[model samples]
Target: MSERVIGGHVAGLITVGAADALWAGLTVGSAVPSASAVFTGSPTLARGGYVLLGRRVVAAVKASGGAWSVPEMEVRRAAAELGAVGMDCRDLVRIGPFGSAPAPHPVHDEGTLLRWRERIARELQKPGGPERAPRDGGHRLSHLAGVDWRQILVERPRMGMAGSWWLPRTVVRLLDTAEHTETQWLHTARTRRIDNAVIEPPPHDGQAQAADAWRTTSQNLPTAPLRPYSGELQGLVYSVVSRKPGISRKVARWACAVCGTAPAAVLDHCHEHGYVRAPVCQSCNTQERPDHLYSNDIRVAGHYTRLFDTDAAVWLRHWHRCPGCRARATLPLPHLAAWTAHVACRTQRPTHREARSSRGRKPCGALRVSWTGGHHAPHTCVLTVVVDFCPSGEHRVLAHVPYREAAEQFRTWLAETVPAVAAVAGPDRIDDLPTHFRPVIADTSSEGQALF
Candidate 1:
């Protein structure tokens, strides 16, 4: 009852009988048994009635507890052979490749074959069972292909035509033949490259003028001299052009001012010392504050630009501060535009380092704190500028400063100081602060400056 493989010994008799019957059908010349006997492979023969004859074989397998995993199409075909008139019922039978030999030993009588036929019919009526279907057009070549041979035998078991038929030397010959066919197929595909079929070429563009220019140059150029020249010409210029500069202007300028960024209308000086700042694109400036606290590098500023583009920034205004830092982040056009233009105009000269003229160098001025405060952790103020007494000593704070200690503090002050300049402004507006201002050092406001 359980769908497990019973021992060969347990189902050995049933396995053998099904196989023998299937073989008899394939080997036309072999002296075959009655149809019921062919299907059930009952050794004992009986006359009189079909019922009594077929019952013995069924009782043998059922008593042995052999099970069938496959359906009953071939078994029914065997049944149909027995059901036909006379015993010349070979027309009702189909032949397939049973491995090797024909049925071994004594054939069953007519009556047993008839009864086995009726029992196989009864087995076919079961619902939700492996329903048999015609395979490979019911041709003799089907068995040579070994198509569904296991299903015909072990799966149905009643067919008695499984292993014994296919394992034959003759069937092995057929298998070798099939393998040869497959080899030929693979060889054709590899040698011929049939998969890569030729395709038509695309149409050429009429507006392509480069070819005409090349033709004209070929006509104008003199032919190679008759003799080879040994002398070299002086001042020969070899040219190479690149749309993308080898070194990014922003990176060059920021790292060392000698290698400057692109040019722009207005320049953002290092307000603390009035050092001429590197040209930064308007795009870089608008996305970030001059603070340099959250993100200082131009590359980082570019990344934020992509993260909050014009439309995205307009949408981002609904959520003012960065959820991560809670700083007063805004997207203004004037700063962005100025930064874009600045980077575009500036260019770095590789030889500018060698051609230095230190004519009008000025002394480093007194410390001047320019910017301070806005949600900077551990300490407040988004940015601050101080002057150092020694080149590397702890810097002294400057007098006037703009500080933003918190989100509310910065936004409130920005409304008054910078106002909302523009959603998108031009190159001139990067460091263009409002006219009205005060020095934090001069005023004794609410709380004294937070200096460490």
Candidate 2:
């Protein structure tokens, strides 16, 4: 064949092959080359090359059966090609729809083009690029670059000192107000003082006259001095002190009447009768004297006597026996007193129905005993006590018994019931107990028993 005919045949085959490949890659399969590739290449050759390259990439992706989606694969292939060819795909922005002019062209210089291509490839490979395939291929490729296009297009005003030069009047006023408010806050915080007059110093000799004047103004008129106590008065004082079992005349004299701490340096007395009521520490004496003078009158003393008598009767009846097993138990004295007071109050203020109901039904003699593994098995056996009462019930904890005491009680009970087990090993031999009884026996020991 002639050279002219051969050249023409070759060109025709190239055109036909390009058209077929473009149709198959863009329409038949999922993969499609980016518009940037088209814009960067020579109009005839570049378009054919991209179309053919896209076809090959789609085929390879399908053959490999990669996990990557169609768009990801296309992007990877395009980036690799652009990087290898030293072509700036970003220069596509200077062409077509992205540029101001119609029908934009590629840059002429090779070095500049190569640098731009490198930058474009780097941007394309970044994490923030378009991850999913766009529905409208033409618009997405031409308009939305991998980078935020809005930031590039929109003009932002220069800020800080440079912005102050040409800022509008309203903006300047707002800024000034904000600055002033911030300045005032800082100044107030820096200068603020905290008053903490926690300790008082001894008065100087110069201030002795002033202090004396103040004390004189504040002091109440002195009452007649207490007369020598008769035998009857002494008996009355003893009776009142003995009512509260834990308190005695000696203890009352040493401890503060109000808080029950610190040495009792001041003797608090009834101003009207000139009778000493109780000894109190200096702080309590100063703070509570006026209130006590009114509240601790003859009538209040009579009420206290009645309360003590009722509490004494209740204590005699129930303080010696455990309600659960009818066992002789040593009740905590303070707890017994408190419980007696509660029962007395309840009985004094029973409703009409409650009074009638109480006559028929047996009275509630239930007592609560709680045991906890204090230091042993703290996480696992936090509360080992067999709680008999509802936790949410309106009942006060009478006393907190030590874990060791509760454990000893459990050991004694075990010794009595399972004498055979006690015979085989001693009462203290908690490890010799049956597997099922181990948890129960363990509860009675200061040191926890191992399960295994």
Candidate 3:
């Protein structure tokens, strides 16, 4: 093997085996070869060397059956490799497929698909590349490089910028600098620091500069005017402030500005004006949200859904809880108050619905919970309970549990409250009842076809 260089006097790229040998030698009281001498004999720190090194390291770590953290010397060596690698390797991801989609290669196991792809995509598709994506309150995750970087960050520098940040610095720095200056390229790349080159990577949706994110560009930024920013956390303040616009995560962490509770759980903003008002807790978030105003208006509903985009598991705060029946509701988005009224309506005993039986006296309560869904999907069954003679008149969904057991519990609760609703008796009643309660589903042959 001979010396290799990428214009820098230092050699680039190192094998995981070499790294292991170096670390093992350092741990014990043995002497290893010079770092430059070792790396120079290996492959050039171009795209091939970079990719192979990462793959070998990940494989070696996996083979060792320990955690995915590379050693300190290895991390430092990797940084030196990035510094020495030529700027021409533009498509290492294209070559390595490190962050490719739809079941492609995985570098960190967890981050390769979504997190790495997102960060790498953010870098690759900047000014000279494709259009930048609009931010939807998603913050940039720092130190997404290796393991959970936060877990072992203390030993980082005797090491390097944890291999997570240092290694990807290859992608972030090398890829962009091929087209731009080293300093200019560092402006927006995802890594927090590269050797002495420290920078603040802005949140995905933030307009703040990478150099100084908290320093507002204009005298009059569209920042929330309610309060000033304050926090012990340094790097994330820009993002937290951007999400709520008015307050930092620290302010939101301990007190709801509206109610002044112990702490706030939600980042609340105004839908109409698009101004971030304050951070609020669950109860306050529900009370302040004018969901009723959005119930009927299609435009407003669309805006609200887009703005909030509540995941079903997050349990969007709602004001529809009952006393004895416990009308706690959890539903997916497209959440109109009218659509979710059944969550509240299901708790109250529905007025006895007149019915006709095959033989004699009619059984009451026409199984008011109407739904059409997959054969065995527990949560897929969106139950809409239409209570009889209830003043609301319109139908609404009370709740849809992710687990069958939860749905069954809900049905049991309904059964204990309104016996006739759960036990279908009349022939006409069978059509409107949920599949779990109905004696027979008219169509059971189809696997996924809707059974209404």
Candidate 4:
């Protein structure tokens, strides 16, 4: 009943199932609390039931992910890091283009981790689990799009639709087809451009499993026949990725930067670095990504601007509105404001190869904050910021206005840029500081600088 993914015949492999893929991939459009779960794809879960859940919880705690290294955590990471840059981890770390979160197994607390295991076990334990799809409205459900119910039995499960039948993408989308969110969940829209080579990779068929568990594996995968693209949209996508200094085909997706809902045919290159910011639809992409068409970028979108919350960090919900109200329309992405602003800031950053210049640059990007330990003298705590961020080895000192103003500015930008900054739960040892939080200021405590 171990959730270790390894068994008698599968010592070096993990037999992936549809549940693993779905739990690993079904991205919720809204971000308030993006639902996430880690799928072990162990064949034991079929009959493991509550026992599987209990075991996984203990194992998760033992992993001590950030602090201690456990085999469970190290295996996948080693498996991923060892197999050419992006192959082995594709199925396991299905985030961003070919990466996300560095390691995908650390996003759980004990309670959530237990529930994640329990959910999958019970879903599989259900009688005729594969056939019994989740309900939509009242009985007799007829048609369901985005799902090939027939193939759930025949085909192997892959990412995206590899979900529990109760909450497969088809079921979730079908149920929320009327969903229109005018709200915020700030996870950025990332690309998962899986090519033919990745579709039926090794994880899809690593080893055999119990017939019953294996049959239920792809229950969430509702797949249909493949359809080749030959439309204007395809041409638009090709044109966007084809242009030099435009979006590289690796991570460029057809999602817009303004309202993430549309097909982004226009590739918006950063005004400064000549790097792609976001691929916007005809309705989005503010920068002259294209000429003939009129585009509404996120900063100036009249109606779209009103959809954001007070912080302007995320979108607002359109669940409740008066008659004839279009509040339910999902215009820009859940993280449009932050993403646009982040991209806007990145525009100031010159690529590593480019020489630095200060024609018209915001001070925030160059600002580096250094703080003294306040534990000894809380009242005498001092925070200092320096203009030290430069690709070329050059540091500039600056006299900041007020301490509070500088701190807030740096904190906000740090959250968007570093992202992992807020998660710094004080390093146990000074040597273990998070990369960005590492002490960079010169050791000026004893007056003159000393040679190392």
Best by lDDT: 3
Give the number of the best model, judged by TM-score.
Answer: 3
lDDT of each: 0.25, 0.26, 0.29, 0.25
lDDT (tens digit, per residue) of candidate 3 on 174-215:
222221221121222223334334332234331112113222
| Order by lDDT, highest first | 3, 2, 4, 1
Q: Write the per-residue lDDT of candidate 1 for residues 309-334, one digit (tens) a residue.
A: 43333323322221111122322221
- Provide the global lDDT of candidate 4 against the true structure: 0.25
lDDT of 2 by residue, 21-111 (tens): 3333333222212333232222212211112232121110111111111222333443344233222222111100111112223442111
Ranking by TM-score: 3, 4, 1, 2
Mind giving the per-residue lDDT tens digits that candidate 4 earns over 243-338?
556343322233344454433334433221122333443323222111110121112112222322232332211111111111212111112222
What global local distance difference test value does model 3 have?
0.29
Candidate 2 residue pairs in backbone clash: 88-117, 407-444
**Cα miss at 218, model 2 (Å)?**
99
